[model samples]
Target chain A: MAEITLDQIIQPENMVYTRSRIMTDTVLHYCPGCGHGTVHRLLAEVIEELDLQSETIGITPVGCSVLMYNYMDIDMQEAAHGRAPALATAIKRLMSEKFVFTYQGDGDLAAIGTAETIHACNRGENITILFINNGIYGMTGGQMAPTTLPDMKASTCPYGRDVQMMGNPLKITDIVATLPGSYYVTRQSVHTPGNVRKAKKAIRKAVEYQKRNQGTCFVEIVSNCNSGWKMTPVDANQWLEENMLPFYPLGDLKVPEE
Target chain B: MGELRLMKGNEAVAEAAIRAGADGYFGYPITPQSEVMEYLMAEKPHERTGMVVLQAESELAAINMVYGGAACGKKVMTSSSSPGISLMQEGISYIAGAELPCLLVNVVRGGPGLGTIQPAQSDYFQSVKGGGHGDYRLITLAPASVQEMSDFVRLGFELAFKYRNPAMILSDGAIGQMMEKVELFDPVPRSKEILPWATTGKTPDRERNIITSLDLDPKRQEDFNLKLQKKYREIEEKEVRFEKIQCDDAEYLFVAYGTSSRVVQKAVQLARSRGIRVGLFRPITLWPFPSKEIFAMTEQVKGILSVEMSAGQMVEDIRLAVKGKIKVDYYGRMGGIIPTPDEVVEMLEKKIIGG
Candidate 1:
């Protein structure tokens, strides 16, 4: 073959993909192999593709992604634990022209912020909620989350989650889908390349629905917390597929009828 | 001149918020202050002035909504009574720490856990001395009449945005439920100018604006605290507002604010008729505490009588202001009872003059 140079190999036509401009140069604070980084990338890509980089407002929950405002180049507000939905509601209502969304975790959205989440969905606030459920409080040293599976080992539940004592694992996504105010409710994962593509598409749809002002759109990403789960990134993905996917099935639970 | 209308204090706050060009009002229905949202909903300020008024699920949600709206650099507010305000303290602290400007109105009611629905000044300590956590203070304005209730809404928002701090109108059920003639101001148009510092949107002209109270780094957090303290000192120096009546020649001073000030005003007149040289000092800005004026009065008065509907809460501030130069006596009714003007004067005589 003729001597090919580096510049010729980096031609625009040969370029496959690049990081979205909506994502700032600030490096993410998430742990190695954490799913939060992937979700953040998907959200940033969606915002860029929709050309909402300037008109998008994001509310970040008090969890591992609390510093998401630093990584995302968008107008952002940091909400108290579990209050992101309420904050997103007000932002969307006051500035109806802007695209508003909340990035939250299971501990934030399902545990302490349950009332706020339910009420916001019930009111049909025109906002998108991106929920990452890893079945444990990742930032707070892996305590038992509301979505923590039965027999799952957590720092608080050292003997594994006892169904009788700790009660059953909660499926907040399904509960929220039953609410009439929720126009679109879906559950997806980013464990595999195929699944990541699907989750990205779901995020784009959620944002599109938000722009149309068609009530609340909730996307629950069944992610994995490798460090919290005490597993290698690959093992964590396998564990999530085995334990979490069975409980939180991978598909749209509710969608507005065409 | 704007129109003059007879309205309740709560109704006046709602109307004044509309005229002040508030972008949104998020509130929950609490006793005494429920009329604030009721009036806003009835008038549909959303249709008239494009004000987004929503009744939140609870006071907690309402305050967070105010935080969200304020983060967008819009004029937002909420009104609640004592119990409701207690639920809002966490949100208030976060708002203060985030340094977002927003208005809050507390229509005071008896409390220590749903104590009563009647008016009480027991929350004086809670309002001015930082009801929430952290080293923070709210620019508290104690409005004594329906007119002041209307006027303070405009003033509260003005001061809130000016200092980028939360401003509170500390009224009670007495003022909130009572009605009087209020000269309404003409509606001020909402500013269309973009807020460069607000989290409106991350436009190309500026870096992204992030509204947050969290600073994990201890050094940065300490810096933020020092900055807030500096702002508070500036406010205390420039915003200490109070009214003095017959103070230059008075021998005794009655220190009060809000409804107690109204009662003390009557007592001042009654004491003067009885040949007692008594005057009233009404603090308009409670957080700034009007310490300078109260301290100056020590030069002219023999003693100061702190009258309130609470169990001598504001008396602490009066004593601090006096600096032991003169005796500051507290006279008041506990629970929700309102002392009569004669009773206040009698207590002053028994507690200070006779002593």
Candidate 2:
């Protein structure tokens, strides 16, 4: 090893990646190894790459990412619980030239906000919806969410999610894909590097569809909640691959034909 | 000069909104106020002034849409009846907490559940005393006529933006449904300047504007609340509006607002004809409540009568204003019943004058 030193590896010509300028210097409030940080990074990168840093506006939901505006260096609005889609609809309609999107969690998008979610997509609102389905309400102390897997234990479902009693785990993305207003619908995770790349691509495509004024584009990130699941980050990734992937499946559920 | 046209109160609200340079109207149909959206849709304000009119899926969605539009610093409004306004309380609270400016028109009907569709003033407490969660108050304007209905639309937006708080036109079905001569004003051109505080977009020249109501830290939330309260106090000191008719040397005062004020005006004339020496104190801004003016009247009047179309909701505010200095009595009709002027006179005579 002839001293191929740190300076050479860190040179601009050799630099492979850097933090997106679309993200502010504020430290993320999410816990260590949380998937929200990865998702936020991917969104920042996609927004920066699309050159939407100035014209893009984001609506954040009432969850852990409620303070997402602090970290994202873009104009943002915080919607009431489950009302992000409704807000996004108004924003897009009022300023059709602007790029608007909503970042929502499972409990926010699938449960309390189901009516707004389906109707926004059904009406073909020209906006993007970034849904994070972590199978539990991560912010409000790991309660059972609408997407909580059957037999998956949550704080509210300590005895495990009984399918018969709690009803089947809702696949809201699938339900939303069937709506005619939705032009593109896909589900991906950010657990692995490959998955992160795919999720970033999906985000870019959704933004592109929004720019074209196609219709509502919904991208669901089936992520993991390590603390909520009471597992280490690595164990949670393994559990997600074995469990969430089978239920949520990684692929495009709907896409418009060219 | 704009046209002086015969229009219903709700229709005037829509037209005035168009002429006032409102940028958007997102509303759901609710009885007694559905004409607001119906008239907007029919008039196509979008074609004329570039105003966006949308019939939302529900009152909940409509209010949130108003929140979004307001966050962008666009003048937006929504109209609903009692039940629908109740559904919008959560969004209204959020708007208040975020300190976004928008107009809300509540053509109140009887309530306490799926109440009647007919006009009533039962939503007084809900509108003025913070209907939604948290300590917040709407700068509530009570429009007593079709002209006031039109006038308040512009005034509501002005006061809303001035304080960066929500303002409401608290009318009733009686005003919303009744036709009257309204002198519409010339269309004010929409502002071309971007609001510095609004979340339009983040340019490289400045930091991003975030419209949010959440402050996870208790101390920060308390500070926000204190700031809101201080703003409310300033509004109370500066924005108390009322019409004091014949109150200089009056023996009895009838405190009423909206349609009840119109009817009470007739009753005051009837009482004067009967040599009862009665005056009318009509509060134009209900949230500012005209408490100082009401307190001043207490020193001059022998008694106060709070007349409304609801079951004594505003009477509490009147009593608080009087502070037990004078005998404050309430006379109201419940379940969407509109009392006649003669009936109001009779109640005044029996409750305040005779007693």
Candidate 3:
């Protein structure tokens, strides 16, 4: 067989895919098969597709992806725990021409930073909020979060979450969708190739809303935490589909009226 | 001076921020400092200069907003009273640690816990001694009059940007609420140049800028801390500001600042009338405090009395400054009580002269 030359294989017609140009060469710190790496790539792809790589300012929450800037070649600010929305609020307000978005986890958005989250959405700030709900506090060793499923066992709820004591898991995205300030609210996942494509489309749409000054765009990605879930990556996806989706079903919660 | 008007100290701060070309002002309403936001809203600088003025839901949100604004290389500020300032300590610490430049004004009321709405200087220790959870220093300015309140807004931004650290105006309820004549400086047009260190979206020309305080690596964190300390040391050497009144012929000294300094001036007058040779020394910068200058006064004075609205917070710094070479005594009223000129003189005569 003839040798496949590097130049020949790299031809545009032969190139099936390439990593997003906005993503840096830095190594990701996520565990193998973790959904964070996938979602990050999706966001990078969206930024590149819209040619906003130089005009986007990202706000990262104080969770596992606190170092999101390390992987993204974009101007970024690391916000305090649950304070990403507050930071995004100011950044978007101060620089209305730039695209600003916050990446927050379930604990940050639904638990510690409830007030910041709710108010930013209610104010209808022109920004995007990307929420990743893994049900448990992944960075803090699996502590149960406000979005932890009922009866789910976590580090803090080792005996399983008792409905009487821990109360019901919060449906924060639904609550956010109800806020008039939010121009678009959607929920998607990246556990599979099909899901990844949908999630990317959702992110691009959210960024479009921000560009139009249409108010806050909240996109919640129900993701997996194999390490925090104490399951293998394959089993975690299976478990998420069978268990997590039943409580936090995925789809657009709110859409712009035609 | 471009404009002359009668204004409350808090109002002066707001007006100065706009005139100084501040990029944003985020704050929540609190007594003794509510006028800061009220005045900003009324002026609508957003319409005039494109500056953002947001009334945040809480002090916590306001300060964090300041962090974000500062991270973007914008001139940002927030004002609050004692309890509100306490709620903002966490955000302030993060800003300090992140090396972001911003301004803060604490129009202080009395408080261990929501003590009173009246003036007090009890936050002296909290302001100077790293109130939040880290070993960082805030460049603190003590504004004495409505003019200084207006003036420090610009000066604070200069110092904050010069060091890439947070600067605070340590004020009190009396100064914040009292109305007096203020000469405002002409507006400084906001600059369009993008700072190299700011987190204002990356261009194809530069490496992306990041605004963060977290350093998981121990060695790098220590180096940053050392760098911060070095900056503070330089500030202490270069920015010590103090005003000495009649100290050339003084035998006794009355040391004070902020609202207390205003009263101590009259007390100095009263003491001199009684043929007591006493002068006043007012510290303008509280963190890069007038320590060396106060120590210099020990050679020309016999005894020193420190007057404040707090029980004795600033006096300890005075003791550290004088280094026990002279007798440094403290006298003040607390729980939002203002000291009278006569009572201050009596304490001076008793605490230092007699003791």
Q: What is the TM-score of chain A in candidate 2?
A: 0.98
**Compared with the true structure, what per-residue lDDT tens digits does model 3 show for residues A47-160?**
998899878999999889999999999999999999999999999898889999999999999999999999999999999999999998999899999999989999999999
Q: In terms of DockQ, which candidate is stronger, 2 or 3?
A: 2
Write one digit per residue (lDDT tens) for candidate 2, span B72-132: 9999999999999999999999999999999999999998899899889999999999999
lDDT of 1 at B317: 91
The deviation in Å at residue B154 for candidate 2 is: 0.2
Model 3 lDDT tens row, B173-273: 99999999999999988868789999888998998999899999999999999998999999999987878888889999999999999999999999999
- Positional deviation of residue B195's Cα in model 1 after best superposition, in angstroms: 1.0
Lowest summed lDDT window (length 10), candidate 2 chain A? A7-16
Model 2, residue B193: C-alpha shift (Å): 1.8
Task: Report the number of the highest-DockQ candidate.
Answer: 2
Every model's DockQ: 0.86, 0.88, 0.85
Report i-RMS for every model: 0.7, 0.6, 0.6
Q: Point out where model 3 deviates above 4 Å.
A: A1-13
- Residues A24-94, candidate 1, lDDT per residue (tens digit)? 89888888889999999999999998899889999999889999999989999999999998888888888
How good is model 1 by TM-score? 0.98
Expressed as tens digits, the lDDT of each residue in A32-151 for candidate 2 is: 888898989999998888889888889999988999999999999999999999999999999999999999999999999999999999999999999999999999999999999999
Q: Worst lDDT window (10 residues) for model 3 chain B?
A: B239-248
Q: Please list the residue runs of candidate 1 whose C-alpha ends up more than 4 Å from where it truly belongs after superposition.
A: A1-13
